[model samples]
Target chain A: MNDMARLQKQRLALYGWMLVAPALALMSLFAFYPAIATLWHSLFTRGTTRRPSVFAGIENYNDLFADPTFWIVVWNNLIYAGITIPVSIIFALAMALWANAHIPARSFVRSAYFTPTILPMIAAANLWLFFYTPDLGVIDQITGFFGASPTNWLGQPETALASVIMVTIWKEAGFFMIFYLAALQTIPPDLREAARIEGAGRWTYTRRVLLPLLMPTTIFVFVNAMINSVKLIDHLFILTKGGPNNASKLILYWIWEMAFAYFDSPHAAAMTILVLLTLGLVAVIQFRLVEKRTHYR
Target chain B: MNTALASRPAKRALPDFDKVLDALGAWVLAIVWISPLLFATWAALQPSGTALGLDFSNPLTFENFTYVWNAVPWAGYFANTVVLVTLILAGQLVLCTLAGFAFARFEFRGRDTIFILVLLQLFILPEVLIVENYAIVSKLGLFDTALGIGLPYMASAFGIFLLRQAFKSVPVELEEAARIEGCSWMGVLWKVYVPAAKPVYLAYALVSIATHWNNFLWPLIVTNSPDTRPLTVGLSLFGAPETGVDISVISAATIMTVAPLLIAFLIFQRQFIQAFLRAGIR
Candidate 1:
């Protein structure tokens, strides 16, 4: 190329770097650096005022593996994810279909479904807490009319996790509905008409055409919900605090407790690394699904 | 004509039953979903005696709201939340716009690699690295400040990704046309690209504001003082079981905490839903 062209090219590259520099710097400080630092810090023993920090390779991870609390937290989180993800997704699809249909009070129904998404999880927990309170609570009041005794929903091991799960499903289903509603809107109306012409009933049209077409959106929402299961433990603070023998403890909540409450940084760091690895696997799967989705389009 | 009328009645009967059933199911679920907020609102407005009662004869009162409002430092929490959300949104717009523009228009070495690295931020969210981030904030002497809570999220990967897609869709001819009129690269961006990406910016702003406003854990960790604690953290503290507050009072506080966003959502219901739809679809 000519000298002028080469100089312009160089200038463009310089401008590009300049534009990207601030974000890169910030990400390094918070995301990239902290991530590496977490792994590094996880390799050392927790230092107090007397003892200097020393290397203890894999000891933190071993300690976490040995802890029964950690194992319980892992199981709890798995159940949390397993239930909340699928149940909420199904509810979202049903909500989207209903709201998109020619139903009475369509907008009100949609609003009712989506309102929970806008409320902070803390507030949602508070609302549910009112409902779960022993005798004076709404659930108990209704059950009382039917002659059933008041139950301690959030106070027992058998019921605490389920109560937490109920709150999560209520909070999330509406949020996911928006994505399905968007996807549903994009689908051409003629497809439904064509299905009808082909002697397909409403159920067949939904199953054979609608659901298949919504696969990409389902995958997207699924991955998002999976990520949320790890991050969304705010309600636990108000509703259960992972109590009643830690029946409702989630992984992220445990990490916070270990690091902040107990002041055990190394163990928290180890758990953080484990969480990161799981998220990395999720990211890989998400990219693959997205690529396949693009190809389908 | 008689045969046509007969077929029409039969055709309408089956679908009518189905439609009625579908609508019934939808309304039932909607009522179940919305009952919590409705119940909360009821408890907030009713006297403590009738807060959880099924009695319809009890009169509604604002005493709970008045009591809770006086007891809590709600004004300070609101101020802190407004400041934090605004700071995060402003920083995110500028940083994400710049990075997105470069990724969209520039031809630099390792550009593709850098884009991938940025995408990785989606997975390595700041919430996951709270331990290290807390130490970093303390080291920087930003502990207990709103800036510390907002800084990590300013360079948001989601915002950048959305803006990049939006910018990439702008026709290259528009940029070339601006350039022919003696526009510099930055001038071209200002005059041509940013304006074209207005909708994406709006969508991102709405999502970011709602997300940060409802954020609890990080703010709960970083801020020890009421001066910096956002609404979510403040609400949690006020409603904690040990606080010895009545259930009605706590419900009042809960409603007060979510009222702003909830009211905004109700007012701009279409825009709020559309914003999430637009932002999530990508």
Candidate 2:
């Protein structure tokens, strides 16, 4: 290029670096550096007094594979994510549709649908803890009026994860609903009117036209819901703490326990590396979809 | 034509069954969805004994609130949360805004690559790095401080991404005009770009405040003592199994911890929802 062009480019480069320096520095310190550090740390065993720090070289990964608890937690997390993601998405869409439709007390309905998103998961857990409490709990009291037996919802291993799943759905659906609501609002009224003119039933129009239009939103919500299932296990701290033999334990929550409770830093690091890999893969897929969707615009 | 016009009036006057059912369904779901919060309110306002029964006719009292308020060092927790959220928000705004402006405006080598790397943080959240982050925090002697709690979140990928989009949308003429006025890089940003992105800043601030205000896992891991513990952590401790699950008192504590955002949401429900709507559009 010309000398003037070269100098302008150089100036741009310098100014760009100067502007982004603070953000880059902080990200390196916290995210990028720690990510590499976690992977590096995962390659070694924790040191004790007698044995100085030495390389274990994938021994932690081997242990993680062999460890039954790790496998159990992995399965539990898959189950958690499997159930919560789809159910929450469906509930979100339903609630959004209902909220957006010509209904009585439209604002109140929308508020009710969206209110749960604001409340802290810990607080929600605390509230649900009361609901899941034995015969004294509201669920049991209502069930008892119909001659049903009272069940210990949170105590039993079989029901514990499911109970937590219920809370996850409750907490996540409203947040996802907002996105669907936004998507719904963007759909032209004329399309619905035209569909009616074409003698399309509600079911046919929704299935053929509306849902196709909402595909981008559905993918976005699904990806977010998946990521949420990975990261959003805060309610577990109050609700279950991976209780009843690790039935409700998610991968992230398991890592926390390994690192802090057991003080097994290396194993936790290995787990962290695994989670990062999974997240990385998921991110790649999400970006591909987002790229297509945004580019399509 | 006369028959058709008469039929239109008759149909309009008739009660629409489907519409009535839809409204009923909406009300039922709304009631069911909000029943947990309703239950918590019921439990908090009544005596613990009657709360279990779902009794609403009993004498209502603020005894649980008073008990919860006096029982915990809630003021300390609230102070920590306010300080932490403010710090994180300030840090995010400054860092994200500058970085966003750079990506949006400047033509530089490896710009796209660096921006993509920054966006990689969208998926590799700080929460996932807690194991190493804890070590990093303690190494920096920032353990149990609000800074430690807020540090990792300050460089938010979401914020940077949102602000970059906002900055890109601001007409280039404004920036050029500011520069023509002999404004420095920061001056152009201040005089033109930042002012133009005000609505975006407000929307982002809402998301940041709500997210940080309810943020649990990181602060929970980083902060050990009550001195630096945010409301979520404090409330978790109060509701732990060992704390004796006095439902009424725990409900009271939960309400107090979440009250500020909840109250704000109840008042500015439109803005709150709109902010989330805006943020989610990405």
Candidate 3:
């Protein structure tokens, strides 16, 4: 009986491995291998027909550090993250509160807020492009009524990044609102009643009783928004192409330009490594926060 | 419980001034949020010259849509998008389910470490690794192909993690009952676990479909020609200012590309929102 049990356990282990093997293989092919290859490739020099590629250590990193465009892209991404994260979170919270309230046409309101989230970023950008056209755009048309001069929203360096940021906020707020809405539903309604009986106003209840309970959801949305600040540059492809002197150029776009457009794979790899490091730091922070949150539960 | 029950009537009876203001504010924001798509729809329906005009009485026409349809290979792009999304969802379902079951029930060595490694893929997303992934795709001779675009995303860490959570929540007794009935592990998984996790599967499927349908950047990089180009890349190429297609035409194409998902979302708004909510909570 003991021998049979051992054999059965061994067979089950084999089955388990077999079950997981396909995913492991694909992940290794795509995720693990590419990640290590990115790190490895970052340390080398870009090869050309005339000269073969060779080990270059941190030369590529140093080059990127010296490039002014690199710094500009980094600054733009930072500002992008800074503005989009908090603003979208705030909008999401407000929308969630209002949507969850005893409002008129509640489902309609929820769907309206969420419709943008369902639209592709590229599609959203295409629609917004018409609004940002120099003189005949929707914003210009509106401002024209008040006699404001036509402003090139996506053309000028000063307003270009801000214009991009506006689109990001518009696209993201609704998506984050869904999370806030979900979190709001999970909060027991009695908390509000208890707070009200204690003479808490709506603002007081929201600030004291609501926001604290929504902390975990807030963190989750914040992390997603942060990742999106890097990943959601599809709009840039449409609205600005990181043009008008690359004012709106994000890190990921710049990386794509370097690797594909400029054929400078090493530098793109180096920048990718930097992005990976930043994301890894974020993952660690998120893990720690989630751990603490679970303990609270 | 008595206080809560007693307060309900009082809460509804009071016509709070703030409540009225709150509803107004909510409606205003909702309009502002949805205005872009509304504007796009308005523009797309207008003739070429009247696209940007605010004249609501302007006669709408299907000319722009027809022009865009004939102008671009939208049919091919739509087919590519449908196939790509379907292929991705199918691959993700199978791979994630099997892997999730293993992690949920199997006692294997190195399981925790391997699970962590899989979880790490969540952060190291394909977009971030585009440079190396592109190189890998070329090395595997999948460049400019739909398979190349789909393969990298097939083994999704998010899907695997979600399914693991779902499967873990399945009652152990159900599995034991199946085992006592002489069901094999595969049989048990299909007959018991999969059925029990149907809601989870539905939620994950909705999320995955929306995600892959809207995915752009990697597809933009991997696909170089119209043959494999998804709607997003196709739309971008068609709408590039250099193409100089009229704004109405571009809007028509934009609406066309997003219409399927947008319509589905409208009809199934509750399911879409719930799916996102379910995906987000974890």
Candidate 4:
């Protein structure tokens, strides 16, 4: 190439660097640096009045491994995910199917289904907070008509996590419904005509053909819901605080308490690493699923 | 499939009994789904338990709202949230636009590699790395401030990715013509690229505002005082166990915090829904 062309190429490269610099610098500070720093910081013991700081080498992990609360948090999170993920997906698919169907006042129904998604989880928690209140609560009042005893929803060990799970499912299903709605809209009309001509029942057609067609959206929403299961503990702060002997605590909330409330940064760091690893696995699956979906298209 | 059938109403010849049952079931489920929000509005308008107990004749009152307004510094929370979201959106637009432009058009050494690294931020979200991020924020002397809450999210990976895709689709001829008109690199970007991406900017801004406005946890940890607490944190604090949990008062507070966004969504329901579809599709 000519000298002028080479100089212009160099100038373009310089411009590229300059353009990306601010975003790269900001991301490094918050996203990238912290990811590395979490691993690095997990090695040192938290400083205290007696001890400055010392490398503990996996001692934090050892402590966490032995801690009953850690086990409980992990177990609770598994149950939370197991229940919310599938149930919400089912509910989302149902919502999408209904909203997309030829129903009277369908937009109103769609609006109702989609509103919870836009509201903050904290607000949703607070709204449900009163429903679980003991005597004066709404649930008890309704059950009182049947002469049934009122149960402590968020206060009890058994019911607290279940209550939170319900809220998560409620918040998520509508959000996922939108994607399913979009996906539902994309399925060709000729398929419906072919199914009708074949004399397939509505249920049979939906189960066999529709579900397979929606596999991509189902996978996408499932991954998103899985990530949200970990990310969404905002309601816990208002509703339970992972309380009633820590029955409702998730791993993320536990990490928060260990770091901020208890000042156990190393322990929190170790927990953070574990969460990142889990997310990484899920992300890899999501990446491959997306790749496959693109290939199919 | 059902939606397609519905659109062609002429072909929806038969309203079978099974179809009627399905539609009824859907309405029932949708009611149950949104009952909490519906309850919040009703309870906020009337006394709390009465709404839940199906006593509609109870005189509607604004006493709960007045009590909640008096109980908390909602004005401060509102202002903080406004400032925080506005600041974050502005920073994201400028930063993401620059980075997206480079990723889309400019070719530099390690350009593809760096772009891949940036995309990885989607998986390793800042939400997950709160432990170290909090420490870093406090260390940078940005602790307990709006900047601290908003700074971590300013360079959004999602925004960069979306804008990159948007910019890439812009016709190269537009850029060349601008260049021929003696436009500088920044000038070409300002005039040619950004205007073509207006829809993207609007979509991203809406998502950002909604997300940041409702954001909790980080703000809960970072901001110790009401001065920096956004509406989410502030509402949670007001409704926390330490304060006596009056259902009416808390509902009123909840309604107040969510009302602005709720109203916006109501007015721009189609836009918000389409924006979310756009976000998801991307």
Candidate 5:
């Protein structure tokens, strides 16, 4: 009887392991393993003569720290995130409120707003490329209505980064609005009615009621938006290629150029570590911010 | 009395100006959002010479699309993308459902820890480790295959996390009764847990399909040949520096590449909205 009980327990253990083994193995190989490998690769260098990788004791990282383009890319990433997240979130919040309000054709309006979110960024960027053309774009045509000369929207360094930022906002705001809309629906109407009974004006009610209800959703949207701004801005490859003297150069685009374009895999790997650390710091800060808010909510 | 009055605001109590402004605001926003699609449609239907001229009155024609269709092997691109997305979805559904069931129903030790680890993986997406992943693909000799493109994303942390939450909401008594009736574990899972979680599955499917279909970076990195390239990468070939293709043909190709997904989305607009809502909440 003792032997049979032990066998049964062992069998269950084996079954559990069997069920989870495939998932764990894949996650480790694909996600966790690469993360650790990138960290390791950052510390080494390919020897100058043979291109054989040798332990360089963080010299690659030192080179990365000293590079001017690296700093420019860093600043560009910061500016990109700073501009994109807040503007997109605010716009999304307003859109969500407007859609959630008792407006006519709300469904049609919501679908139209949400359409851009699903379109492939590459395809949308192509569409925007046409829109940004100096002579052919609609924007140029509209500007011509006021007797202004055609301006090179994407070709000029001054407007290149902002142009990319604008497209990013257009692509993301509607999607973020969906989150705000969901959160808005969960805020019971009774609470708003109670505020109304107390003579709270629309501004007062929004400041005192809706905004507080939306704090958690706002944090989620913010962090997700930040992640996107950092990780998924690949449309630069087609639209600008970080061109016009690297004015639109972003960190991921830089990494792509280093790896494939310049054939500097080791340097690319090192820069990835910097990118990873930046993302990690931001994620940690976001986690801390959200954790504090959870106690009060 | 005040509560009643507030709950049912009198029709004449508020100024009608507020509602009128709201309507105007929504209409203006919708038109702005739809203008890009409108513009793209305009560009894609016109001839190459007149396309860049923005001659809206030149009248619509099917010539640009047919030109693009013959210029590229779009049929191959569409087939590859469909196969890739379907395989990824089918894999995710089975894997996520099983893992979610295990975490939600089983009393096994270390389950909570493992589930938290899975959630953590969501933040550490594979994109961050692209260099090492590329090496892994090359070493496995799966480079340039749809299977390679789909393999890394097959087991999604988000899907598992979501489906587990869904499964936990299933009543325990339902499972117990099935057990008492001599039903096997798998049978109970299929009979009770799955049926109860249909909506969650549909929501997950929609999100997964949209994501995989629109994925550009990974596919761009993996696929080096035209035979295996998806639409986004195929569109790039037309825009290559060497091609010198006209903008009208490029727009035509872009429309052809994205139209299937767009049309499907238009038809199932409500489902897409609801799925996004459900995903956001989860």
Candidate 6:
């Protein structure tokens, strides 16, 4: 009887371990292992062949700090994130308000706004590349219609980076609008009615009630949008290759170039470490904001 | 008496004004929202020679579609993408469920610490670690394989966090009742926990598929050869500098690549919007 009881206990313990085993194992290998290995790679120098590598201490990181291109990439990323986040958030809120209003064909308008969100970033980039073409694209034709000279949207150093940022905002705004819409739904209907009964103006109600209520959603959007801006590189590759003299060079794009184009694995790893550190800082800010907001709520 | 009555009327009058303003604003916004997409669809139909032409006289043609298909291996890409997305989803569902349950129910030591560490992974994205990840994949002999491409995302922190939240909401009494009835832990999970979390599972599935379907950089790096390359990466090769691609052909290719998801979104927009809202609740 005791032996049977021991057997049952063993089986239950086995079952419990099995339940958590797959998750722990997969995460350890894929997520945790790669992250640790990346840190290791940063400390190593590449040998003659790609396969062989040796420990090289802080040299890779040293090269990163001294490189002018590294600074340029960092500057570009900051400018891109700074411009895109606020613009996208404002646009998203405006769109959500428009959609949430008693509009004719509201459903159609909502889907139309979100159409770009469903499209792949690469595909959208390609489509926009067509429009940005100087000689044969649609944007040039539109300019010509207005009797203006055709602009080399992607070809020029000055316009290329701005063009990329614009496309990103256009793609992201409507998607963020959905979050705003959800937040809008959660607002009690009686509040809006009571505001109306109290003789509150539209702008007054929006400022006093809606904006404050939307604060959490706005913060959430800001964090995700910032993360996206830092990580976005697909469009850069097809759009300009960080060029018209590397005007559009972002940190991640530069890391890709370092690893694949330059075949400098150590330098790429070092740059990646920097990107990770930046992300960590952003995350800290996000957590503090979230905690403070929760307290306010 | 007249002045006091007039003021109350003004209060009622203000809502009427707001309504009119909202209605007008909605129509104006709708037109602006729809125009760019309508223009893109219009342009997609035009031939290369006349696509950029300002004239509206040239009729729409299917030649661009023909050109796109013949120019790229889109069929092969479509097949590879299906395999990749499906494999990733299957792996994630199982892994996330287990981890989520563990975090939600188990009284294991250091649980919060380990879970917090997992959540920290959200900040350290795979893109930033792509260089070393590639090295790791090559070492494991998973390069040029769908499993390799999907491996990085299989244990998603978002999924774990989301499912954990949902699992926690299931009543403890229900779990206890199942235990009293001589139900095994696995039976309770399958019978009670999963059933209760069905809506969350659906929402997570859609989000996962949408994300992985549109994923570009990692798959581009891991899968080099055409046999393994997904649609986005495959389409890149078609438009490489070595091969001069016309604007119309590229647009056609773009449409082909994005059409499936767009069509699905249109068909199930209600569900899509609902799922998206659920995700936002996070």
Expressed as tens digits, the lDDT of each residue in B1-282 for candidate 5 is 123543465444563677788889988988888887877788888877678687658888889889877878888888999999999999888878888877776655677788877877877867767788888998999899988898899778888888889989999999899989999878988999999999999999998999888888888888998788888888876765336777777788878878888898899988988898787666
Ranked by lDDT, top first? 1, 3, 4, 2, 5, 6
Q: How far is candidate 2 from the true structure (C-alpha RMSD, Å)?
A: 3.0
The candidate that achieves the highest DockQ relative to the unseen native structure? 4
**Given candidate 3, what's the lDDT at residue B178?**
95
Q: Which residue pairs show backbone clashes in model 4?
A: none
lDDT of each: 0.92, 0.88, 0.90, 0.89, 0.83, 0.82
Per-prediction CA RMSD (Å): 2.7, 3.0, 2.0, 2.2, 2.6, 4.0
Worst 10 residues of 4 chain A by lDDT: A129-138
Better of 1 and 3 by DockQ: 3
Q: What does DockQ come to for candidate 6? A: 0.43
Q: Where is model 5 chain A poorest over a 10-residue stretch in terms of lDDT?
A: A12-21
Model 2's chain A TM-score stands at 0.95
* Two-chain DockQ for each candidate model: 0.62, 0.61, 0.68, 0.72, 0.53, 0.43
CAPRI verdict (incorrect, acceptable, medium, high) for model 5: medium
Interface CA RMSD, all predictions: 3.4, 3.3, 2.0, 1.7, 2.7, 4.4
Please write out the lDDT profile of model 2 over residues A1-297, one tens digit for every residue: 699998988988899999898998989999999999998999998988998779989999999999999899999999999999999999999888888877769899989988889888899898898789989898898899999999988888999999999998988899999998888888877786677678777789889988889989999999999999898899899888898788888999999999999999999999999998998899889889989988877
lDDT of 4 by residue, B188-278 (tens): 9999999999998988898899899889989888898988889999898888966766676788899999999999999999889888878
lDDT of 4 by residue, A92-199 (tens): 999998898888899989988899888998999998876787766778888887899989889899899999999999998998999999989888878877887788
TM-score of chain A of each: 0.97, 0.95, 0.98, 0.97, 0.94, 0.91
Query: Candidates ranked by DockQ, best first?
Result: 4, 3, 1, 2, 5, 6
Misplaced by over 4 Å in model 4 are A295-297, B1-15, B47-54
Name the top lDDT candidate. Answer: 1
lDDT of 2 by residue, B100-147 (tens): 999999988888998899889888978889999999999999999999
Candidate 2, CAPRI quality class derived from DockQ: medium
